[model samples]
Target chain A: MRRIMTGPNVVLWLFMIVALLTGCRGGAPLTSWPGLTVAEGIVYVAAGAKVYALEADTGNQKWEFPGEEKKGPFYATPGVEEGLVFVGSNDNNLYALDAVTGNQRWSFATQKPIIAGPAVAGDTVYVASADSKVYALEAATGVGRWEFTTGNWIWATPLVADDKVYVGSMDHKMYCLDAESGQERWEFEAGGGIAATPTLAGDLLYFGAYDGKVYALDAASGQKKWEFQSGGWVWSQPLVVGDTVYVGSMDKMVYALDATSGQKKWEFATEGAVLAGPAFADDLLYVASEDKQLYAVDAATGQKRWWFTAQTSIFAPPALADGVVYTCSQDGRVYALNAGNGNQRWVFPRTEQ
Target chain B: MSQVWNLLLQGMVNSLLFLYDVLAHNFALSIAVFTVLVRLLTLPFTLPAQRSAKAQQELQPEIEKIRKKYAKDKEKQTQETMKLYKEKGINPAMGCLPMFLQLPIMFAFYQSIVKALANTPLQMVSLGKFASPSLSQLVPLGSHFLWLDLGYPDPLYILPILVVATTWIQQKVATPPSTDSQAASMTQSMQITMPLMFGFITMSLASGLAVYFVISNLVGIAIQYFITGGGGLLPQRGKKGK
Candidate 1:
């Protein structure tokens, strides 16, 4: 070893070659943005491997799931119904936990990662998975009631309303399934893959697809009523109120469109992709963007009212409760801000002193 | 610096997406086509490097002798090596130049595969940023090909095996016979170790990348065979193509 050159010159050459090979991010993120929701004064957010139940007002950790053993990087926004918290894990299991204690109630296994949040309707849990299947399970026991297969990955949360389940798949189709039997009622082919949960208002079903279009279809018949083009993929569920729908797009813009006509009302630009849905409360819409900012925009005008910058990008929609807005940043921290002034209330895992 | 790098990445992502569209939306096929296209485009530089490496390997025995002859004089050994290289029209530095040029492309291709697959939310968003508006519909180029999802590692371990085999064949063909016992020993270990390492890595890597490696290696083997006049895989270094 001593016979060969062993000095700064050799080190310099090695460093130069290494510098050349690196800099490309060669792998996808193993985990994704924190998915959170506010229900019953508790903010339940799934990030990395655990789901944390936090105080909506103080950002205080109430309890974290799987207290000791690590099993997942859960990214699905949790659903709370009948005292059970339903959240899906990257480990391909949907765990139903006791909402108060974070104790595991039961878990249902899927063939692949469950990225979409589970929808709890009455006594049934409807969850879509990346395995290209939708499962209907008993809410209390996690028993499989029925399963429906699709042509491709299902990333959108199942929309359950009036005994009908609407799910979107990366197969570029939106499906309507009977709630009890998991039988296909109808499916409408879209120009691209659908990732956002379909929004239902009146007789129309609204969704955004990867083809940069927002579609309105007759829910009962799966008939395409109209399609509105956006600048990029629409991954966020449309927020429908009155006759207008607000949706976000990967083109770094949030759109306001007429719910029935599919005509654009106005568009507000962001510095980065809008991956998550927007929330409306008190005439203000809270939209999260990859731009590392949670923007509070005037609902009627589509103009920014105020914004609060986080430590990193945001891809999870804000959960609004009692004038307090909760957002999960990609950095795995949750922030509570005043809905009126956009003033920071608190942040989880408080910054190091 | 990042902006320029991102532009290049976007260009690579777009090309892969375009090929996917034209190639029946088969992601695996598009990756193969993309690999071949890249190899073809870089052939001018890469071919010479391969030829130069092969030429240098064939010239190794003679160079070893010269080194031993001038073992006491470092400057004399270097001078003799240079003289021999020049006489044979082999530029020692040409090999390094092309490899240095290629590292970025190889890494960028890897990044593109990960971005184009879009198996996860974060990955999908990144892919969206780079894709042209016209290719938005292709946001998630099909990941399924036969039994393998190009976005995930092959479950049957077939692609990884192919990766190891092809890489070994290329390394074996490209390595020149060496006169020095220590040098030949290092070459032997390297020929075995490099392919194995790649295979082990491939077992966990996205099958799409494993597909890229296999295709890239097969092309490399063909070009290497043509360049070195069919250097057999098992031949000893000092006697190869002699």
Candidate 2:
């Protein structure tokens, strides 16, 4: 007694396979690292559909934006300035919320999703969007001042300093622009797309690219100073402290390099890729990895002093304010810990006790 | 079990990226080439089933005659059918094996396209983890190709039309006409519905996946033509020429 697949069986089986292939592939709304920012005893985080403002110490909810969940998810760390907090949404709009009340002051819409945080200097908010354009908006009114189009997506948050705006695009180029008029001053082409924001120290600019290379360039002239190759895509913004530059790589190694020479000093291994930039205070560098661990590596020796494991991956860079290191998990929970130890002080979006 | 599936996914992602890098960084070309390679690679599974189906189809008239002969006895009809299958060396179960083997590969290929395009941050992270380190620079492959952004849907609807047309053409050339009225009717309805259903899905899918469908169907049509001696598409034209 053997089974024979009739013609109807063949058609039915093909239909089932096609249904399984297409039906189960519903998109999950484009996830990345949760945007967590701690400032002035208030932690403003853009995770999921709402930006939550929690008390920096207790993790008690201060206020959530819009008083309702929005359609698009937000992952860009909110930029705090003046009395307003600026954050970008996957909905293609950058919203300005009052720092204390979490009330939306205004929102300036871009043509595509916003993947990076907004940078505010003085009266203007500089935003880079997946639309491949960098926009300058009036901070108070959210009116577009001017926009500069890049050749590809701009996932790197714009860095504004000394009347100059530095930003990188997936076009494999970093451009320096006049902070006021959105006019390009100079652009330096890298070997791959830049996802990490440019870290400016004195006259030198440091950043990593998808090419798995860390680069140092003269901030003013857009000339390459030196480059050090990493094992994988350097998605982290290189943290420049004193004469040392610390960066994380998708290769699961964190390398510390000489700031001026771009030579590797030491490297520390992690269990998973380090997607977030390292945070520094005192003698320790707080780094988050996709291994679900927040590591406090010694600033000088590149040795892990302590680590605190979250329930899920921690891809967002930990932020520090008032001796507290704030970290986020992909599960939408935030952990506030003592900077000296990786001990959790409180967790947000509280679980029932 | 999940880990093995991930490794298979990793293989597809790396292969696609590797192809993209070597083929002048054109993602469209990478997808088409990858689809052909996958079809060819899986031919070991598919070819046997295809041959079995054709053989079964060819013996349909004999099977019908046997059924009429054993009309008085139900057990005799099944016995005769099994005997006939043995005599012809045709096992209908061969069709089931290919379905099981090819389903996973086809599903993985669909996922690889989405991962390669990486339109979202979560997708980007997953792709980065799955892609080979040597191909990191190609993780978020350029999606732009001739008025189409592979990460997004085709606004012009050109790829959808092409997908429907190629799928319909392949079905037309691949379906063997049958004297069994029930089987012929089911095959005929499937040819109409499947092409239109896939075309509708293509309207919203990443144009890159649509490109893969169009290419896969064309390759399928070619294989089917050779396997079934040009099936039905070219036979009518040949008769006209004669």
Could you say which candidate leads in DockQ? 2
- Tens digit per residue, CA lDDT, model 1, A146-257: 9999988898999999899999999899999999999999999998889999999999999999898999999989999999988888899999989999999988999999
lDDT of 2 at B112: 84
Please provide TM-scores, in order, for all candidate models, with all chains considered together: 0.91, 0.92
lDDT on C-alpha atoms for all candidate structures? 0.84, 0.84
User: How does chain B score by TM in each prediction?
Assistant: 0.91, 0.92
TM-score of model 2 (CA atoms): 0.92
lDDT by residue (B43-96, candidate 2, tens digit) is 887788778777876787898999899999999999999999999888878866
How far residue B136's Cα lies from its native spot in candidate 2, in Å, is: 3.7
Model 1 chain A scores worst on lDDT over the 10 consecutive residues at: A1-10
Please list the residue runs of candidate 1 whose C-alpha ends up more than 4 Å from where it truly belongs after superposition.
A1-29, A351-353, B54-65, B86-90, B232-242
**Ten residues in sequence with the least summed lDDT for candidate 2 chain A:** A1-10
